[model samples]
Target: MNQQLIAFLAYLSPSLFVITALTSWYQAGLRPTAVKKLGMISSFFGILSSLILAYAVYQQDLIEISTFSIYGLGLSLRLDTVSMLMFSMIAILSFVIMRYSLNYLDGDHRQGTFLGRLAATIVSVQFLVLSGNLAVLLASWILTSLCLHRLLVFYKKRPGAIIAAKKKSIVARLADISLLIGFVLLYQIFGTGNLEIIFQNVREGISPLLATATIFIALAALLKSAQFPTHGWLLEVMETPTPVSSLLHAGLLNAGPFLIIRLAFIMEATSTASTLLIILGAFTAIYGSVVYLTQTSIKTALGYSSIAHMGFSLMVCGLGVYPAAMLHLIAHSFYKAHSFLSSGSVIDLIRAAKVTGAKRIGNPFKIILGILLAIAMYSSFAYLWGVDIQNEFQLFVIGGIIVLGLSRLFSFALDSNASIKLWFQALVLSAVVALAFFSLESIFHFFLMGNVPELTIPSLSEVILMSTVLTLFGLVVFIQIFSPILNQKSSFQALAVHIRNGLYINVVFDRIVRAHYHKEDSNSRIVLEEAEIGKYILDSKENNNEEQEERLA
Candidate 1:
């Protein structure tokens, strides 16, 4: 319960990860089983330390520790509610994923190297979230990218992995420069690099330089989160390893929204930055979601899903709903981790379930009716949850999106049967969604009371933004309800191909990157083939054959 004890506990987990990572590399003579046991032990201690820190922070509002200083910058850590939540997530996921790798990479020649690097990456991200100074935060951010690049190129002979890592490095360098500029501008304006001082200055009033700094930070977040143009690397990196994909998609990609949330106060002051975040994030969300529907590769689909999720998170931050963004971050992390780790079983799972005949396509009028019903359900649930109908236009629109999705899902369920049991199930499902919405909102309101400024009313621009997003999602609902009818047309099929090809966006980038960086015969490094599902299926078949040979021998 003491502040000093909390600080010690806060430092313990990352230190344990770093020490274990170093030992894994140096103690290479140990058997694989012994090395795995060491990893398990280190992970357990890390989780335990994180649990202690979480408890301490829950009891105390916030805890700050300044251990030392280099130059004029203080080496400090701030354990607030948000940072505590992020720390716990990193500790838990690292433990689970490392355990998964024990079997996932059982017989690899460089298993030890992979484990060490994974631990090192985890440590860097943990430090980044907990850092109390801008200098330390920036250094940790860059360190995380470097470690991820190494993991991306773990199979050095694989040309695809090499290309993906190279492209990712370029994007990350751009992000790093943006973040550095933002930090310098902040220090110049506030006359201090300390986060506390900067936040105090932001609270007093926004200076002219603050808005420019916030825009730089927003740009850095967009790049880091793989917004539109920078998302090619994310889709291509699936060649590295499953565990690596799990870590990158589920853990590292979250740093972008985390950065935005960390500076929400400054961002709220700048309407230009907020509007930019809203527009860009909304566009990315729509683009990624559509492309995801077209992709055949499971990892590539998941990559697009990550992009969409991150965009939506940024949009929530732009709307002044910081707590909701945090909730989105934590939920998406766990969901994507499970999705990636279980990706290999997808084919088996699908084969086990037999599909019945498809439902008859609904007419346009019926689909329109479904939309209106969804709006009604959303309104009822929002009222029950005490959502202010007069204000919070963004929240109302978001609730409508969720309800619309649920309606599409239930449309199929209700089409088959008119039974009371099915109807009861649908009602319960809607209630669960409503309950979750309010529960997360309540927790966020309690923990992040003053940190994130409240939105009083929606501006005209915000209203337009809200309408555009709702219309986009509404179109998606309409398409889902009547897909069987639309797919029969030729134009629809042609559009499907383009969407599946990611509208040839990455193709343009591929040529530009190769022309600039690749002097040798780069004929084989075409990025279009990178996201094909067949590539992974072939790789799996080869691995299976090798395992069969080993067993026979």
Candidate 2:
């Protein structure tokens, strides 16, 4: 529990975890069940050690352990609040996924190798998150990417998965290269790779050149986090196993935000960089939300939602709400992971129902669930925007309440027979309305003396305008849901198709890579086949010639 011991354990855990996973992989060939059990055992120990180190870090101000440099890069580990939080989450989630994969990947030929890479990824991510210096961070970042790229392609026999894996590789390598370049630039400008020292110097006043270097670092974070325009790779990454998807998209996806948070701390005094972050974050949030509204596949929908949530976190950071952002990040990781796991179960249920001659009946529970989710999302948005019931923002909040009510009414109309659905809808709606009202009243009291009293209740005309707009948006979504049944094409159908294609961003990238790099010629396969035939003919001719010569002799 001492600081020194914690630092030592933190420094040693990554290598030990990887070694343990590799050993298990070797044993899997002979005893698959035993190997899986070993993996779980190793993960349990790793998590325990990480938690102890986290406790030590909380007791001490900071824990640092320095070892000799490797290849001119200093090997040091630091445990702080941010790093400890990330490490603990990764440890716990990776262990759960490893346990789940035992059942999920049963009887797979490459199960051992897949599990090994998974372990390696967990270690690499922990190292990257805990690294004290840029050199160490960059090394672990690249290692993590490599491990993920391999796991992405574990089902290489599936052509689509292979293609997706290749795309992930390209994006990950680009991110790695960007990170490396940023690190070199930082080192050159700051004359050190230690994050703590650099942050101190930056707080004082970094040079213009170093500020430019910081921009590059920000770019790297944006790409790694799957910000707008660079988010194509993340969508395709769903080809990986469900547990991997849960870990990568829900757990590891936060790495980019973590990096941004770190940078925000370092560059707190830099107005220009902060402004850029705000703009990027706001743009990505809006873009991602628009995309999310149109997705059909549940996982892909969640992917866009993840991007949007991260965007919200980034925006909160931009607004100088670090605690809020961190809170939201933690909240999102749990909820999103649960949603994905539930989605996998839903998929299985649908499959089973199909096999039993049961038509895919609409579950009234789903509608109630969707309405509850909408209310939660609405409240979160309101809270983030500083809305109070007594202020002008209250109009928006009230409008949201009305919308929620209307949505429940629609749910009732759609599923009149489901009493459970009606009860669930009523319960959730009442709770949401009560919470929103209380929050609004509190805000109103805070600004009571201000001139914005009338803002709480918009004029009748204004209410009509705002309500009309929201109703239109809701109507669009509703129509899209029932359009197929109505035998009419809805405008939202086109939007859905576009989002499903990921806005053609990947297609554009594929075109650019193909247009410049040139693919192997289709004729190459034909030529290879012809060459093999020619070789056969030549061997036959030589045999005939030998037979003729022997007869002549």
Candidate 3:
């Protein structure tokens, strides 16, 4: 693959999407059906371009294309392993979501307009990943959010959708501001916005200006990822179209960790920003994991799941495990896209699920045994694999987190009725999964070798923060095991209510919003009500047909 050809193929994707957007807008009213075909074509083209870009970059580490220069920043497309990987993932996911949308918006009006906006949004993200300059990155970041805002509020009649969009808009602007200011600060300090040059400066020293900018960037990532307490909008966005939800969750929400990795050198330079990421990411992960279990609605449950996963990704980034975060983000995007697209099937599964009455608590002895076994398994595997806990603390702690999660499996295996074979099988399964995780971690780290550096030596406080993450997840496992007993207590019940309502975090945002955009939204569930009404009508027709058959007989 020639560098010039790779560049052309990379540019072809966004160019195709730009054409699709324009065609959709112009022909939406006249030939609505054609809009989808055009969007899918553009998306599939993007996937092809991504694969070619990946192979070309593998041969020659990086392919840089400087289109032009403006305001101290070069408008360039930089294709490396990280960028190429993200490109392929985003392109493939967008294509799948677009295909799903063909049936999703079957009879919607102005379908062309929606597909156009969606295509435009996909292109914005595509450009962002390929960006080689801070200026281009910031521009693409803002544009991505702006384009998605329309999709979030696609159901204008649904007040829930409107409110979610409003909340997200407010947060998005704050994120943009923090990111822009971070760039401005970096530009003032380094006198250039070329990311490579700035990265070099970052290695020289961690000055006050650099640290400040890094903290601001961290704040922006937190907001973009919808970290705890400010995550209500993410959960309440269920009123929007399913495709919109999938795109936002699976594609857009990953921008936070991606932003961290893009500026990996700066994040590695400043311990303050890294600490901030660790604290917030740990809290958000724990909060999301715990609260999601109590959610009755599928979208909100998935919403919490995204939050938890994002937090974990950020945590990995803050720990200087950039490759691990990348892997986590890519895997989560696929799972979340599938989760949102097949949400109807999930609902059916839940309906068909049988609930057992009078749950009994697992034996405390068994729980303790499970925890010990999980820890021993992880420790032994890490040692056997030559994972130096003292040196490579990042890999060690992340691997530990996965094993703690496996504690649940161990607990189940330790059931009183379980045979010795079951316990042995559980241990073997744990080893296989643990080995796979370590294998993937090493593979991504190898691919990202020089590009994403690890902190090798851990500071005392940093080590404690990572320890806290492991502790937090361990507590979650314990809670799950004893939930049957805890559910009976009033205090636990009250806490569940608060968690279910997202601890009233969004209420503050709502109050702020109502002060400016007050409205009578008491009965603003138009979309859901319409769905129910349609179902009712269909059921009535079925009943009438059955009666007619009986009369004719």
Clash count of each predicted structure: 0, 1, 0
lDDT of 1 by residue, 369-412 (tens): 55565567777767777888568776777677787777775664
Per-residue lDDT of 374-457 in model 2, one digit per residue for the tens?
Answer: 566566656665666444532453346345554544444343444465556655665565465445545433422211112224
Q: Model 3, stretches more than 4 Å misplaced?
A: 29-31, 353-361, 416-429, 519-553
Q: Residue 261 of candidate 1: its Cα lDDT?
A: 84
Candidate 1's TM-score reads 0.91
**Runs of candidate 2 exceeding 4 Å displacement:** 28-30, 69-73, 350-496, 515-553
lDDT, model 1, position 451 = 61
lDDT for each of the candidates? 0.81, 0.66, 0.85
lDDT by residue for model 3 (1-553), tens: 7667877898898998898888886766534666777788888898888887888888889777888887769688888888988999999998998888777877777678888888899999999899999888999999999998988887786667887888898889999999999999999998888887788878886668988999999999999999976777897788878988899999899999999998898888878998899889988988898888888888889999999999989988888989889999999999999999999998898789996533244678887788788888888878777898789988888887888777877877784466788778888898888887888888998999878876569988778888877887878878886765688899999888998877777787678667236455535555567887899899999999999999999
Q: Could you say which candidate leads in lDDT? A: 3
Better of 1 and 2 by TM-score: 1
Model 1 misplaced stretches (Cα beyond 4 Å): 27-30, 70-72, 414-427, 515-553
TM-score of each: 0.91, 0.71, 0.91
Q: Quick one: best TM-score, which candidate?
A: 3
**RMSD, one per candidate, in order:** 4.0, 11.3, 3.5
